[model samples]
Target: MAVARSRSSAGPVGYAVGDITSLDFPDGHFDGVRCERVLQHVREPDAAIKELIRVTRPRGRVCVIDTDWSSSVANGFDHLDEDIAEFFPEDNDPAAGRAIRSRMVRAGLRHTTALPVALRFTSLTDAGVVVPFFNCGAMQSRVRAELIERFFASVERSVDRGGLLFAFTMWIGLGQVPLGSMPRNVS
Candidate 1:
């Protein structure tokens, strides 16, 4: 953070890294907040969302964006989806993205909305820019060696056939804090 601040041209910037489940700021401090791609790794995503609401002022907006790995697909390869899902790191929630809006609604945030976005890639080289699985070594989960070989071979075939297609859904969820309301059970 210090490195970023030093390199930045903006003046008088402040940076604080606090626990998402329990923010350090006072209640209703900010006009808007955005938590992006962080909830999937959280042990209690709901609590984190509530904390975001707690720190947002009334009529403020909170946006949460996350990826649902279960929605990942690589067409032209039969085992691609299975491989990606099975080999994905367990610490991240594969279904967390799709659930963000529903969790916000359950937290009593008004004017809730969910937007589903699909990211598509047709080549391994291009896909590697965003999806790390294409590079193989970036995988954190344990997968069978033979399966990896087969997966790569299939990918090669797909690439040769000019049919490689990879896509996954990432959700953008939004909600507005109600007038004079705090998230239930949140201070």
Candidate 2:
């Protein structure tokens, strides 16, 4: 956030650290709202989406981008992937990305669209940035060190043979707030 605040030159653009599920803004405060890669980490993603819709003006756009960790796939590593898939939700909301569009519609947003983007990784170093299993150094307390080490050992071997290929889907959901006003608490 400090980096973002430093790099952004637009004076009208303001940044504040606040809760997503319960923002401090009033209704129809912003023309448009966007949330990126945040829902999957929150305790109540639907509430966050509702809050996003609540703050945007009628007919304004709201966009949410998040990862569908369930869509993760690794070439020649299906077993390991399955193990992690079950384990991921113990720590994060792995299905948040795929659920965004429907949630928006359910929250009364119109013209909702969801687009899936495949993020492919060929090297362990690059995949480690986003894929938790690939980063052994992170979340050492939450994840079993032995499992991560074993997985990375296999990944390293596969990479040495030039066969490590993994990918996951990220979804971008966009919608417009309904032109007709409804009670903010209804959604």
Candidate 3:
């Protein structure tokens, strides 16, 4: 409702809540489609990517932005990476960002390009939004309480020494639907 009200003063803007893997739009309905930070949470990211390409008209563009959580790094603490892996697990598709480009190409998009973007944070609180292990409260497990506290203590020590650093990479992929071509049902 807020978005609708906010855009009411501006020119026409459309918004619909729908499944990315099965978009309701007709084939070649949109001139451009863009999805951000969503594929990582999806079970079939490639299917969603194909759907994004499907809605775009011939010669139209498709853009996707997603995080490669496997590329996440925390410089201040030891064993932090292992702990994160144990907590989050690889089944989350931590490499989704790095894989979208190839997925788009395989789906028959032309002129596909992928760019890696490094996101750096000096504050643990800020990094917590993207990396939950950075947030102490978010890691409340009876078995791992001591380990979590120890990790935060190390982070604090690093901050005191001015050595704290957190970084992760996200990828932005762009592809163009070829002219005179219609997207096939890749499902």
Q: Across residues 90-146, which tens digit of lDDT does each residue of candidate 3 receive?
A: 555767899989999998899999999999988777878876677766677422777
Better lDDT candidate (1, 3): 1
For model 2, residues 1-187, the per-residue Cα lDDT tens digits are: 9999889997677889998988888999999998998988887787888899999999999999999977887884434654465455564687789999999998889999999999999988898898766777664645666666677778888988899999889999999999877427433
- Kindly report which residue pairs in candidate 3 clash with one another: none
Relative to the true structure, how large is the alpha-carbon lDDT of every model?
0.84, 0.83, 0.82
lDDT string for model 1 (84-145, tens) is 66655666686799999999998879999999999999989888767756767755355677
> After aligning candidate 1 to the native by TM-score, how far in Å is the CA of 97 from where it should be?
1.9
RMSD, each candidate, Å?
A: 3.3, 2.6, 3.6
Lowest summed lDDT across 10 adjacent residues in model 3 is found at 82-91
Stretches off by above 4 angstroms in model 1 are 1-15, 86-92, 135-137, 140-150, 184-187
TM-score of model number 3: 0.78
Clashes of 3: 0
Give the number of the best model, judged by lDDT: 1
Worst 10-residue lDDT window, candidate 1: 135-144
Q: How much lDDT does candidate 3 score?
A: 0.82
